[model samples]
Target: MLEKKLHSLSLNQIQIEDMFWKEYMELVRNHVIPYQWEALNDRIKEAEPSYCIQNFRVAAKLEEGSFQGMVFQDSDVYKWLEAVAYSLMWHPDEKLEQTADETIDLIAAAQQPDGYLDTYYIINGLEKRFTNLMDHHELYCLGHMVEAAVAYYKATGKRKFLDVAIAYADCAAEHLGTEEGKIPGYPGHEVAEMALVALYEVTGEERHLNLAKYFIDQRGQEPLFFNEECKKNDNKCFWDDTYMQKQYYQAGKPVREQEKAEGHAVRAVYLYSGMAEVASATEDAELFKVCEKIWDNIVKKQMYVTGAIGATEHGEAFSFDYDLPNDTVYAETCAAIGLIFFARRMFEITKDSKYTDIMERALFNGVISGMSLDGKNFFYVNPLEVNPEACEKDYFKRHVKPVRQKWFGCACCPPNVARLLSSIGGYAFECSEDAIYMNLFVGGQIEAALNGKKNRFHVETQYPWEGTVKIKVENQEDSSFTYAVRIPGWCQNYELTINGVKPEYYVEKGYAILNHVWKNGDEILLKMDMPVTLVEANPRVREDIGKVAVMRGPVVYCLEEIDNQDQLQEIYLEENPVFTETFEKDLLKGVVTLKTQGKRLSEKNWGEETLYRPYRGRTYEKQELTFIPYYAWTNRGIGEMTVWVRI
Candidate 1:
């Protein structure tokens, strides 16, 4: 219901030189990006065979071999290029840029006449194209292609890759949609919608925007396009009455009619994010309302405490409302990254603080949990609770891995994390003609244009661990603008001072706004009180009754078996537990570990190890407990981890 529109800063405009995020970004550039490139080329002998580059060569007729990876193997190359593009934006490396350019050349060679570029279809057969649109991922690959092309153009102002992407998009426009002699089809996996929007933003092509809008509109119509396409090709109906449902692809009904979060979590969020973009561009109030309703459904009822979206491991989809199980959870890393995409789009349309809050929450905890400190290992499924034996022995908990793996054949999360972290500066702040919104309080420098004049500002902070932030305006003395600092949803008490003088200010939608004439060396200091608070889920969430998760600032803290004793379930919170915080400079690459007093319940005091035993009074022994950031849990040889403990 909010009215203000958002305009995110350009990737080059905001530079992150932060103590925390800069390290992660460097890790992506130095380790993850190069590592993923090696993986795509099938050079990593220890990792799974991706066959990404080989497939391109086969499709291009430069080599003779069969495609050996997933139908979407081509996306791996595209995602890596996108990550490299974002990486080169601020940390320009000629070697990385050359590598990406060469990869793009291989991709360009793989394109078929009339501008079709999917390696699966190019090598497999163009006759097979669009026939299996339900699962072939043709549009999905094109989506990544367009996204990478846009980033590359923005990063290096290179038109070669963008030209390739536009050619393919034009082909899509000619083939798909509801026009006469055109097939009415949409993507099995989304991303094309938003990617097309990005293309339109760069090229100012009305067809690209219209094509994206057409895809959104044609989906889930009376005759579902997916069903019709499947029936035409003798493929089984995607919405089989017996097993899989159309909701699995978020195509059960028209997007506006679909009120609840359903289907594959990543697909659903990507599709919704695209819908938000189209709604924003078209200024469609009804479509905007759909976004708001769906956002409410996801964030209010379905989202996990750690900001992960999906609930069930089956199909990696959401379960029933308030059915957020902690132990058997499938909070896919890709889905959390998709949530950030969705939230950012929602924020662009409504300029709501709630959307930014979710983005920050997911970034600091669930999303980053996908990557390890070393930046080589990654988790595809980020579960809230971990039990090593249960993860190994229990079939229901099979998707939850106790430790990050070296690689996967799919290889989605590692590169997805890399792309997000590399381009993270775009998410930190947004600016208008005369106002600046500090979205995330990370140490950075922003160079932007306001009122036809260039302005610069420098921010210094030890955020997420320490609560104090100092920002200095570096504009000319006569320049004036409104500065807005986001007061995080978790913060309860804070103080702000300008030029060392406290001033009365008004908070609008979680942002403390100060309108002032900026001058060089004008300093603003913000102090937020950091306290260990207990967070409880809504009463509707049956899994988290009479339990609390420890939180300080934006980070969610968890108890791991490495710190606590074995048998994690026996741990209980003390009635009036006192928590003390200390900075461990050498632990987990320097984090603030929280220490508290708790009790370990005596499991042996029970009468017997029976399923149904009447509980007598149980004995408890005091134990000192240590909690680390949830994102840093499995870095030290994972065993057991729990966020919500007995209170």
Candidate 2:
């Protein structure tokens, strides 16, 4: 039997002061949140209009305008509000809280008498609501709304937003399910399944839990509900393409029978996340096994070196096994974020460090790459390789942006980044009945009760750049509990000592288990060797067969056109190259850059117009290649960037 499931430390319980994460948290608090608020209200000049706020007003009949933006645009505001809720937990601001409250009030006003919300249906026509469950994202919007409401209520102790969420949930419960007169349909886009689970956790509503389960159980069942609905609706879909097929929605087969991770990348992970959560809550071992199988498939075969997924741009989705492309990849930012969500929940259920490893990988590399250092511009597609000319000229690589844009018309990735970064404290720590799991090496102060005894800890570290973590325990009463510190998968050499002496420790699934009676001022030190590593992909990955990716700790390194000359593809690393680490405080918001001696395939002997130049035994000149953290690329003007270089 599984032990009691672990619970993440609440956002209020952990205060992040990490030199690495604090910058991101502060960026979300100060710049990203404010900028998104303006964008949502359609106030950002020279950018695409959001009209999210105006849609709510129009739905409430407080203003006269048709619904604008994507049908799921409401989620952008909810995601921003969720980020604000997390930010307010650590950085209190009266003005921001007031704005959020006002926004919640507007949301409440837009809700119908039947407790139905969603400006697209409310403003368009209430009669047509739920008519196209396979296309319209009504359920998807409600999911984000509930998530925001839960976060806000936790932050402010305000029930207004929570009440709205409960009411809308009740409305959904009344309409969707297996009972007579119910729609018996799930979201075309996922997240509702997980959001309903969140609502169930907060409200203790069995129906919410059941609704989430029903969505999961009903998905990919025989005589697919999506097909039936499509037939009923005369085959009209919001996104009419090959993506409208059942496989793209991950509804081609029953959830339990599905093996490989497939379909839209975001939807696949979002569904898997919900499955993990519901399985944990209900102790469904079968469902948990399914999650494990898919997780293995994704991390082993499908994922990129930077923890990115969705190998193809066609559906913004996963391609076949071992088909992870480099340039024409559509590794959306939200897909990586969703993978983190799944990884965290899996860790919570199983107390396994592998889950946290992937979670850390995605958090440090793929997720952060979505937002700029200043937190203004955003990238929807986080490609591992980029060439300006190819991105412009090659039709297949059109989605690959050489530079992060100020805003996007779709605009989901920015606010998603905001919420994830703001609430990062929750991801860093987890508490069980008899153990405290330190998942991510983030510098912070955390307070949690283990085995009914309160304990406070101070963690200090400069991770990703340097790996020396010092943890100090403070508690009034001497407590005996296991403190599980993760030994990151990438760290081959590490030393852990308690109070200046190495303790008797046991390794369990990648975590160094230190079971001891804790006391005040008992300090623990962890030193992980941060050596630059050259990583080569599996031979199956043809794109990276003879190439190497530079990495230090969890940060993947990339070569940009600014640091090296253009034609980044011409760069090559010698076998067993040596790298020197340099901390440049002035560059890309104080990052540790790696300098290495490598060879660049010289074009000096070739003509300027030579497109098909034969490699005459590969003439090369030795050059010092500069490698910055992959997340920091594109911050300094658009240039050629590649994570993999030929060796």
Candidate 3:
């Protein structure tokens, strides 16, 4: 039953454990956790007079809040919940669980009785609820709250917060759902459907599920949100209906007809993920097919080299296929987190290892990159390239920028990562009955019931940071079972062994099966070399054709301007850069840094270009530059930075 349930993520015992606790969860625990907390602290501590104030950055000092405001509502509770649930994943720790409980309790207290919730504007006043769903993100906030409660309940078996989630959900259902007396609309955001699905999973409550379905179905149908906005503003609202029409949001068509990704990057992906869930639950093959089709379009054509999605800076949305611009890549962290959610759901729907493969990709580079190395600062938008100078010179620079921030005025990434990592365990494995399937590898022990008896499995490994792994069974002296392991698309030549005896079938890049009768003291080990890989963006991704992003194991690396003083255009790599693995004594641990020899002009004389002058490509002299994991940028002082430095 377990094998069939997780038929797709059938990873070896060692790989599953290593990826889970070592690479994936540790990145969440050590790095992502701290940054999210810092953002939350910024939100709690920096509110002006009565407003819950937050800026796009610490020193940018500009307070611009919108849907990002709603994201923080979830951040307040989600990350703590993730940490709490994670404590049990590798090994149980009492302190982690307590922290999780405390955070959830605070979230419940933060909500008011009428179900009008949102910490940002609510800190200023509750009158703002439902008034500005177009931008204030009230429903979006409620959506996140529902998600947190369901997660907390699942992770800790406590429903105190779940009740709060339900109350907020009830408010949404009662107040805004039906148009009998009020306006007819859906969240300008897309979290409610996803959260409602989670609530349904936890309580088996149909109202919650029906409401979730309602949100998905209501979208793109009648009285468009923009139309409502226009009616509210008497035509002064910022929306351009023409833009909305071209966008993925069909406000005119039912969800079953909406095909392309559109609107806000984060919202679009989240909505798609929720739709995937709805389709999976209802067994709506048509909807599920659309979900898979969108998934293919994203991974094959829309995804970033860092596993990030959503290309266009306008609306921070996904544009045409291969329209990837490194420096201008919006690559919103919430969108990447959404990509993980969407990918995971698709994996669940199809039980495909490829989904897990992409899941691991998003988790390591695209996902973790949102948080700074010290864990305090964050990048709401994880661009593949950064031009510190252009960031200052160009005011239109929403997508291209440098350095991490204390908080975002539109700060959704911080809390999204928090909740995602805190609940990272759910993405690691699945359980049904008899057969046990290992999805990821991490050193830990898990207790489960098999054949009506209690049993334990002790797994140990060095994962993302390294590839070696080991696994051992505990408690049960003898038994018969099957452990299906995933073969990564990246792994070229791999080997698996049991008790030093190699398995007859080779561990190919896409598959490896280990089916056998098991006993106590049995062991398995997997060893693979994560060769230095230079990945060029697809040919159609014109911006990245000549450039390459360095990736080893699970982390993707980039060269920032601070690490190289010369302007990016002046530098050019003569050959593939040399791989020099190094460890930052304190910050990012057990890492590889790729170094390169490049050329730069000594003269600082070349300036402007004639309107139609023929440009010349010239360069000289060799210099040293290092590429650290994209997740580790801006930790040092911010300067001119570019992930896609020339060459």
**In model 2, what is the error at residue 590, expressed in angstroms?**
1.0
Candidate 1 wrongly placed segments (more than 4 Å): 1-4, 237-244, 605-614
What value does the lDDT take at residue 246 in candidate 2? 79
- Decoy 3 TM-score against native: 0.83
- Find the 10 residues in a row with the least total lDDT in model 3: 50-59
Winner by lDDT between candidate 3 and candidate 1: 1
Better of 1 and 3 by TM-score: 1
Which residue pairs clash in candidate 2? none
**Clashing residue pair totals per candidate (backbone < 3 A):** 0, 0, 26
lDDT against the true structure, per candidate, is 0.88, 0.90, 0.65
Residue-level lDDT of model 3, residues 1-647, one tens digit each, is 11124422112222234433445456566665544555455533542111122311211223334333443444444534544454444445677667666666556556676755566554555565566565556677677667766655654577787887788888778876656876556777777788788788778989888888888777766656656755775544344634655244435567777666656678888888888878877767887777777778788888887889878777777778788877777888888898888877776655677887888888887888887655556677887766677777876675565777766655566666666655564566554455454556556665555545555677776666667767676765666555556667777766788888986553333446566666777777778777777777777878876776667876787776767774666666656566666655454544556776766754444546534435565447778777777777777777655656556
Better of 2 and 3 by TM-score: 2
TM-score of each: 0.97, 0.98, 0.83
Model 3: per-residue Cα lDDT at residue 257: 76
Cα lDDT, model 2, residue 57: 93
| Order by TM-score, highest first | 2, 1, 3
Runs in model 3 with CA error above 4 Å?
1-4, 7-132, 176-183, 223-237, 245-252, 398-400, 450-455, 504-511, 575-587, 596-619, 623-625, 645-647
Where does candidate 1 have its weakest 10-residue lDDT segment?
Answer: 235-244
